[model samples]
Target: MSDPIVPPILPREFGVYFALLEVSALVQHGVEGQLRRDGGLSFVQFQILAILGEDPSSPRSMTDLADRLVHSRSGLTYQVDRLEQAGLVARVPSEQDERGVNVTLTPTGAAVLARVLPGHADEVREVIVDALDGADRDELTRLLRQVARHLRSRPPRSARRAPTRSAEA
Candidate 1:
């Protein structure tokens, strides 16, 4: 039997990939823990509040919020439902489109976000920014942005439909 062909990753490329994964996981864990403990919110819940807080005057559609957060539509809906129940966010039918729903941050949500942001910022600085000097941080940001842009331009593999088998023999 022939061995399957496998592409070899360059040593440097493999190291970069591993570093990115480890750093991302560690940072996310730290942030999630802080949010859960200090803010009484999950990371995703805090993210929703932050996004809504970005423009209190403007209510964002669910679809827009999902896209911005890179979340599935159904998942975003569930989060919004929970937030609504907690009085952190309110939902209203879109003025421009009756079929669409828009989410806005409530005063309570804004206050909670204001209260949590300081700790969140501190945690982020401790986990990531403070570890790097200013120049290295800027370079890292630029490089990561380039990589993100390239990745975002492509359709996600999960979004693609799989091939179907033919019925005719």
Candidate 2:
């Protein structure tokens, strides 16, 4: 077998990457735990509700929701199904596209979000905001925004077309 190829990563760059990974994982876990205990919602479910709650009257297409949330189509479908069962969200057939489904935040979902948002904000402040000073927060935001822009400029793996056999050869 051919040896595995490894990309060159500078020591400093690797340190930054490791720090980001650890911070993200820890923060996400904390937020997830808080959401579960306080709101009885998973992180993804809370994200879905927050997205829909942004414009309660505007129904977002499933594709839009999946893209915005960075969730797989199938995963979003399952979560939406659960939320629907709980009467927290509703799926409506899109008038613009017969094949498309639009999801909207239900009244119950909005109420839950309203109840959960204060605690969510507090958790965010505790885990992230309060940990950084103004300048540090601004610098971090700038750096992360640059990274996000670069990453998002490319098509996601699932969305990219695979190379044909002829092209590979």
Candidate 3:
């Protein structure tokens, strides 16, 4: 096989790609480490727990949870299933929508999150917040949000409707 093309050579700010990779790896490592040591939750699992804990509405529809998680519906269902098996979450039928399922943290999940969150916050602060003073952090957040918004506005190739085939064909 031939070597893949290096990304940095591109004129556009491909720096974001490298930055995304680096930050993702670093954050994943820290969160995974903390979760393994303190709570036995993986990073994605922790994220789900944290989101549910933070939201006032404890139980939410699977589709709603997927949207909140930025995970595809199928992907979120798999994660939620794993969490359910782990005794960290419970999935119930949604009253508001019979077609939807509601996912909620179990008491076990809530207790675990309560125990782990302080240490998790510290790990986040150490790796992210503590690296920058408040002003720089604020500016960084603003700039990053603008970039994210720009990127999000661009539709994926799959999102565009395909041309219809004539019935005669």
Candidate 4:
């Protein structure tokens, strides 16, 4: 048999970081696959639906939804347009701000979410939660939250910190 191709062992500091990113991507793909094959929804689509479900009465502006999803305005518009065409959601002129538009999940969308959520929850448990024992899952949760907290404090890409002065200076 041919020798297996493997990446050179990464540095200790970066190893877990890279592995976490890879695992995150793979798990997202797995969830996406289940959504597509079983529920006919894309991951982004499901996220949008979940957000709407979170506050059905509140008018979710297109810009707000885009910001919440970290998507470009145009990309979000495209997704919302598709959802509108599918009759899953509707865009209404914002009563509070006529210049803006609000997206609302239709009854059909709500019904669909109600039907799909239980199955989706089970799939999530199977693909992620069930794979970990209780202790590990709790530890992962705590660690991930800590990482998220730290990440939120980092400066944006365009911002840079000034250099510290040396003691001699």
Number of the candidate with higher TM-score, 2 or 4: 2
- What local distance difference test score does each model get? 0.89, 0.91, 0.81, 0.81
Q: What tens digits encode model 1's per-residue C-alpha lDDT throughout 62-152?
A: 8778877788878888999988998999999899998988999999889989989999999999999999999999999999999988987
lDDT of 3 by residue, 86-115 (tens): 898998788888787788888888999999
Question: All candidates: CA RMSD in angstroms?
Answer: 3.2, 3.5, 4.9, 8.3
Q: Pick the candidate with the highest lDDT.
A: 2
Each prediction's TM-score against the native? 0.86, 0.88, 0.79, 0.77
Q: For candidate 2, lDDT tens digit of each residue in 1-169?
A: 9997776987798999999999999999999998888878999999999999999999999888887887888899999999999999999989899898899999999998998899899999999999999999999999999998898788764476667688557
Pull out the clashing pairs in model 3: none
Pairing residues by index, what is the TM-score of model 3?
A: 0.79
Q: Highest TM-score among the candidates is held by which one?
A: 2
Where does candidate 3 have its weakest 10-residue lDDT segment? 154-163
lDDT score, candidate 3, position 29? 99
TM-score of 1: 0.86
lDDT (Cα, 0-100) at 87 in candidate 2: 94
